[model samples]
Target: MKREMKEQLRQVFDTPDTRRKEEFLQNFNYPKATYREFLFRQIGYIRKRVWGLSLVLILSAFAVCKIMKDNDATYSMVWVISSLFPLLALLASTEIARSSSFRMSELEMTTRFNLGEVLLMRMGILGLTNAFVFGIVLFSVAFKINYGCLQLGLYLSVPYLISCLGSLILMNKISSREVVYCCAGVSCFVSVFNGILANSKPMIYSDKFVFFWIVLFILLCIAIVNQGSKLIKKTEALQWN
Candidate 1:
C-alpha cells in the first residue's frame, strides 16, 4: 500500500511544469553539477577586464613614484590616495552593473537559479576583484609613500562604499544600466573633490572620527547585502504586476 502511494505521487510530479519548477528550485544545477561553473564564468569576465584596471593603477603609481622620488614632501601621498581610489570605485561600480550593461537581465532573471542568487554571486565576484586591487595599492603605498594606514584606508573605504551603496539605492529610481553611469559620474566628482580636499587639508579624518567611519562602513555593507535579496524579489514581482 505504501509503494502504491509513492507511485501515485511520482506520477503527479511527472509533468514538464513540475520538472521545470524543481530544476529552478535546485538553482540552475543539474543533479551532478554545482554553481562553481557560474563562479568561474564571473572570474573569467573579471580577468578579461583586468587590463583596464591595471592600466589605471600602473599609470597612477608611476606618476606618484616619480614625483615622490624627486621630493621628500609627505603631502604627495595625499594626491596619490585621492587620485587612485575614486577611479577604482568608478570601475567597480561599472563591474557591478555588468548584467544591465549587456542587456542580459531577462535571461538572467528566469534561469533555474533565478535572478536573486545570480545577482548575489556576481556581486561577490566583483567584491573580490576590488579587494585584490585594493590590496595591491595598499602594498605599494606602504613601500613608497609615508602615510598613516588609517588615512589611506579611509580614503579607499569611504569612496568605495559610497559608490556601491549609492548604486544599490538608485536602483529604485533608475534602470540598472543608468545607475552604473550615475555611479561612475559621482565617483569622478568625488575623486576631484577628494583630491582638492586632500591637498588643501591633509588627513581630514582625525583619530576621534576613525571609530565613526568604521561603524558607518559596517552598516553600509550590511545594508547592501540585505538589499540584494530584496531587489531580486522586487524585480521579478514587477513582471506579474
Candidate 2:
C-alpha cells in the first residue's frame, strides 16, 4: 500500500510537458546582472599569474633603482626599464589574445558579451594596470636619474608600444596556436633590442634625440590602433557565419 501511494505521488508530480514548464518559467521574472557588475566580474576571470608577474616587475624596478643609485651605472637603468616594459606589454596582449589562443572564439560569440566586448574589457583593465605600474616605476627612476619624466617615460613606453604593435600584428596574421610563440618571440626581441640600444647607441637616450623618439612613438600608436581595429573586425565577422 505504501509503494502504491509513493507511485501515485510521483506520477502526479512528474510533468512530461516541457512546453508547460517553459511557459511557467517565462512568467517568472529573473533579475539581470547590471553592466557594471558584469564588467567588474571579468576581473576575477583574469589569470592570477598575470598579477603575480606584474608585482614582481614592479618590485624589480624598485630594486634596480636602489642598487644603481650610488653607482656609475645610471644609464643601465634605461636598459632594465626598457627590457621590462616589453614583458609588461606582452602580458596585456596575451590576455587580449586569449580567445584566439585557446580557440574559444566560437563559444564567445554565443555569449551575451560577444568576443569584441570581452577583448576590449580585458584589454582596458590590463592596459590601465600596466600603465599605472609603468608610471610608478618610471617616476621612481626619474628621481635617481637626471632625465625629465617625459624623456624617461618615452624610454620605457617605446619598447612597450613596440611589443604591443608586434603582438597585435602577429595575432591578426598568424594562426591561433602559433600566436603565443610569436608573441613571446616579439617580447624577447624588443627586450634584446633595448640592450643593443643601450650598448651600441647610448647617446640615443640623450634629450637631443628625444624628438625622434616622439615621432617613432606616435607612429607606433597609429599602427597599433589600425592593427587592433583589424583584429576586432576579423573576430566579429565570424559571428555572421
Candidate 3:
C-alpha cells in the first residue's frame, strides 16, 4: 500500500520533461517591481523611531507656536521653530549615513539592491518626508506669525540646509559609526547657533538682511548638492571594490 501510494504521489508530482521545462522557461513572465512600488516598499522599512521622533518634533513645535501666539512672542516662535530644523536633519542624515555607520556597506552591496541604490532611495524618501514635515511646520508658523512665506521659509530653511550641508560633508569625510554622532553634534551646534543669533542679532531676520539670507540659502544649496554627489560616487566606488 505504501509503495503504491508513493508511486501515485510520484506520478502526480513528477518533474517536468526537458522539452516542457524549456517551453515554460521561454514563456515565463518574471514580475518586476516598478520604481514607485519599490519606493513605497522602502518607506515601510524605515525605522519607526524616525517617524515617531518627527511627529514629536512637529507636535512640540506646534505647541510652542501656540504658546508663543498667546504671549505675542513672534521672534521667539521663529527661533523655536528654526532651532528644531537641525533635529530633522539629524534624523535624515543618520538614516542615510546608517550604512557606513554600522559597517553594513559590504553586506548591502551583495544584496539585490546595491548599496548606492539603497542609499539613494533612502535619502530620497527621508528627504521628501522631512521636507513635507518642514513645509507643514513652516506654513503653520507662518500663518500665525507676521512673517511672509519667503521670510519664514528662509528663516526655517537656512538652518536645516546648513545642517544638511554639514552632514553631507562630514559623511564624505568620515566612514565610521562615529560619523553619525558627529552629525548629531553638528546639528546641535546649528540649533545652539540659531539660539545665539535670535538672542544677539535679531536684526538678521529683518527686511534689510533678507537678501543676505537669500544669498546664503543659494550657496548652501549648491554646497549640499556638490557634497551629496560626492557621497553617492563614493558609495558606488565601494560597491565595485
Candidate 4:
C-alpha cells in the first residue's frame, strides 16, 4: 500500500502536462471541505463546548420576557433584547480571542488547522444561537404587544450588527473582559436609542422607514463582514503580552 501511494505521488510529480501538474499541486495544497462538512466539524465542536453559555442566555432571555406582565409593555422587550442578546453574543465572540488572552497565540498559530476558519466558526455559532434565542423571545412578545415581523427582525438585527462591528473592532485591541465591558456599554446606549426611537415620534410607523432601515442594515452588514475578515487575520497574528 505504501509502495503504491509512493508510485502514484511520483507519477504526479513527474507528469509532463503542466495543467495536470498544477491541478495535482492545487489538490495537495487545499483539502476538500464543503459547507455542510464544515458545519458538522467546526460548528459541532462549538455546539458541544458552548452549550452551557447558550442555555444560560436563552433561559435569561425567556425569564426576562416572562416577567413583563403588561401586554403594552412600553418598549420593554425592545430595550431588553437590544441590550441583552447582542451583549451576550458579543461576549461570546471573545471566546475565540482566548488565544491572545491566555497567551496561547503562538501555539495556535502553529496548528495545522485554519485559525481564521476556527474564529469564524466560533463567531457564527455564537451569533446564530443568540439570534435564535432572541427571535423566540421577540416572537413571543409579538403575541402580547404590537410589532410587525419586519419591525421585529430589523430592530433586533440593528444592534446585533452593531455589536458585531464593535467586537470585530476591539477583538485585537484589548482583553476579552474589556471587550465585554466596552460592548455592553455600546449595547446599552443603543438600546436606549432604540427605546426612544420606538416610543417617541416613532419612525417605524412612517412610510419607507423599512426601506430606509433595510438599506442602512445592508450597508452596515457590508462593513461588519469586511471588518470581521480583517479581525480574523488580526486574531491569527495577535501578539502575546
Candidate 5:
C-alpha cells in the first residue's frame, strides 16, 4: 500500500499536462489579464475626474481660508484631507472595472472559461497595474512634498499596496458597490490614523505598525488566493452540468 501510494504520487507529479494545469490554475486564481485590463480601464476612467476634483477641492479650501479668519485652521485641515483624491480615484476605478468585467463574463458564459477564472484574471491585472500607478504617485508625492523618496515610499507604498490586495480579496466576495464603500471607509481610516500618528509624535517608531500591517496583508492575500482557487474548481465542475 505504501509503495502503491508513492507510485501514484509520482505519476501525479510527473504528468506534464497535470503540471501545466496546476500552473494554469495558479495563474487563473490570480488572473493577471483581468487585473491588467481593470487597471488600464480604471486609470482612464479617473484621469479627468482626479484633476477636476483636486482643483475644485484646492480652490474651495483656499477660498474658505481667505473668507473666514477664525476658520483658517479648519480650512487648512480640510485642504490636507483633500489630498486623498488619488486614493479615492483608485477605489472608484476598482468598482467600475470589477462590475463591468462581471457583466461581460456573464454574457460570455458559453466560452471555455469559467466566471471565477475570469474574475481572477481581471483582479490580478488590476492589482499589478494599480501597484505600478501607485508607485509613480508615491514618487511624485515624495518629490512634491520634499520628503525622502525612499522613506516615504517605504511607509506609504507598503500600506497602499497591501490595501490594493485587500481590495482584491474583498472584490471576490462582495458586490461592486460594497467593495467601493468598504475600500473608501478603510482607506479613510488608515489615512486618518497615519496622519494623526505622524503629526502627534514625530519620533515614534513606525516599525511595529508596519510589521503588523504586513502580517495582516499576507494573511488576507493567502485567503483570497485560496478562495479564488476553490471558486474556479467549483465553477469548472459546474460546467459539466
Candidate 6:
C-alpha cells in the first residue's frame, strides 16, 4: 500500500500539465507581469488636460477676485471652492483610469497575472497624484491669503486630506462621471449647510464637538479602506484578463 501511494504521488507531481501550470503561475506572479503599464500611460495622458483645466479655473477665479476686491467684497468664494475641487478631480480621473485598466485586465485574464498588484499600483498612483495637487493648491492659497504660511498650510491641508479620504471612498463605488456629479451635489449641500449654520448663534463650542468631528473623519478613513478592499476583491473575483 505504501509503495502504491508513493507511485501515485510521483505521477501527480510529474504530470506535464501540472508542471506547465506551475511554471505559468510562477511567471504570472511576477511584479512586472501584473504592473499594468497602460494605466500609467493613461494617467500621463490625462495629466496635461487636467492641469490645463485647473489652470483656467484658477486664473478665472483670480480675475473674479480682483474685480470683487475693487468693490470691497473680495474674498473669493470661487478660490475656496477650487481648493476642494482637486480632491474631486483626482478621484474622478483615477477612477476613469482604473476602470479602463480593469477592463483591459479582464480581457487579458488568460494571462498569468494577479489583479491585486494592479489595484495596489492604482491606489498608490492616485495617492501620489492627489498629494502633489493638494500641495500646489495649498501653496497658492497661502500666497493669496498672505497669512502666516504655517497657519494657512494647516487649515488647507487638513480639510484637503479629509476630502481626499471622502473621494477615495466615493470612487471605490462609483464611475468617473458619477463621482463628478456626486461631488457637485455634496459640495452644494455642504455649502448650503455651512451658510445656514454660520448665520445661526452657536450654542456649543465644546470639546465634544471637536472630538465628534475627529471621530467622524476617522470613520470616513475606515470606510474608504474597506470600500477600496472590496473593490480589489471584486475585481480579483471577476478574473479580468
Computed on alpha carbons, the lDDT of every model, listed in order, comes to 0.67, 0.86, 0.90, 0.66, 0.50, 0.52
Collision pairs in model 4: none
Whole-model alpha-carbon lDDT for candidate 1: 0.67
- Single out the weakest 10-residue window by summed lDDT for candidate 5: 74-83
Compared with the true structure, what per-residue lDDT tens digits does model 5 show for residues 95-168?
A: 43454334543443444445555555555554565555545555444434433555444555444544555555
lDDT of 1 by residue, 127-184 (tens): 7767787777666666665547765666556766766666666654566467777877
lDDT of 6 at 74: 22
Worst 10 residues of 1 by lDDT: 232-241
Q: What is the lDDT of residue 204 in candidate 5?
A: 34
Could you tell me the TM-score of candidate 1? Answer: 0.72
Query: Model 3 over residues 23-111: C-alpha lDDT tens digits?
Result: 89768886566778778877987899999999999999999998999999989889888999999999999999888887878887876
Candidate 6 lDDT, 145-219, residue by residue in tens: 544545444433444444555555565667445665565555455444433543362332223455554565567
Off by over 4 Å in 3: 1-33
CA deviation > 4 Å runs, candidate 6: 1-42, 45-48, 57-79, 82-87, 90-105, 108-114, 144-184, 187-223
lDDT of 2 by residue, 29-76 (tens): 765667797688889878999999999999999988888776768899
Q: Tell me each candidate's RMSD, in Å, in order.
A: 7.5, 10.3, 10.9, 9.6, 11.0, 6.7
Query: What TM-score do all the candidates reach, one by one?
Result: 0.72, 0.85, 0.85, 0.66, 0.47, 0.55
**Candidate 1, position 123, lDDT:** 69
